[model samples]
Target: MSQFVLHDELWWVSEFSCESCGTRLCEHAGPGAAPDDVRQALLAAHGSVTLRPTGPAPGLVPVLRALREASGVSLPQARELAAELVRDGLAGTPAEMGLLRDALHRRGVPADVQS
Candidate 1:
């Protein structure tokens, strides 16, 4: 088995693969999986919700706390949401952040730290 690490600004995805069987442990999905559907299913199953943290230090702590209080979402779900926000640029701009926060609130999230 061969192992590899894939890192981004906010994620560290670990992958394992067997060169012989071509089996791998990764989030690296094929094109047919459709990122949107994969994301949505992940969100629903994990109870993940993304939000922009308040103030200059945008962080995932507050967003995770809020979701925990609001829906008792698991840490993994919160983690997935945090990852998505970081990837989707939801935390990059006011409008985009607002959209993400609003979507979370609609899904029963209690707090939105987004400005």
Candidate 2:
């Protein structure tokens, strides 16, 4: 399994094969995050990343909206994420944090990714 952000989109691809039986399967998704299990495995292997706001704090509305769009989460989820950011930053895999960071920057909300 491999997942990363490319061309401003998340690319998730998984390949499964059996050497003896000569059977193979592949599942790939476009423009979105990987399944939770895959993401968790990556996070466990590479450690976690944190995205925190930097510079001056921005308005709540823009922050929430940026987070919502970046993560493709609902408004309430965005609020929770925003709260998490305010508390200890948003924590996730590198791809996720980086994508969120880009989104925040695009929305004029300064942020930094900590690995």
Candidate 3:
């Protein structure tokens, strides 16, 4: 199972359990993307949502900062993400997209989440 958790910052956890043996193990993540397998599972099960920037171009600086604060991506990664936002926006789980939408809003960038 994979779950999203909110703490001082956002986090994610995945767990495995054995029904017969009653054994369990879990993994936790910091404030950023979940593991690739976990994310893939979620997308396969629930589909993906996209965030689209609306109105005039918001510029690269605000988008870079939004990606940095919301996803904790490195500066170079943020730059790439910013480009994607201007080009086609970004896609992820609803929660992930919402996090970015709000971050962009806070930076005065107009954007919306699309299901």
Question: What lDDT would candidate 1 get against the real structure?
Answer: 0.43
The true-versus-predicted C-alpha distance at residue 41 of model 2, in Å, is 1.5
lDDT ranking of the models: 2, 3, 1
How do all models score by TM-score?
Answer: 0.29, 0.86, 0.78
lDDT string, candidate 2, 5-53, tens digits: 8887777777789999999988776667788888877777789989988
Model 1 misplacement above 4 A? 1-58, 89-115
Backbone clashes in model 2, listed as residue pairs: none
Give the number of the best model, judged by lDDT. 2
Instruction: Name every residue pair that clashes in candidate 1.
Output: none
lDDT of residue 96 for candidate 1: 26
Please provide, for model 3 over 12-107, each residue's C-alpha lDDT reduced to its tens digit, 9 standing for 90 to 100: 666778899999887654555777898887788778999998876457788788889888889999998888887898998766887788888989
Per-residue CA lDDT of model 1 for 11-101, tens digit only, reads 1223468899999778653222224554454445444433543333234576565444433459988677666655552332222234445
lDDT of 3: 0.79
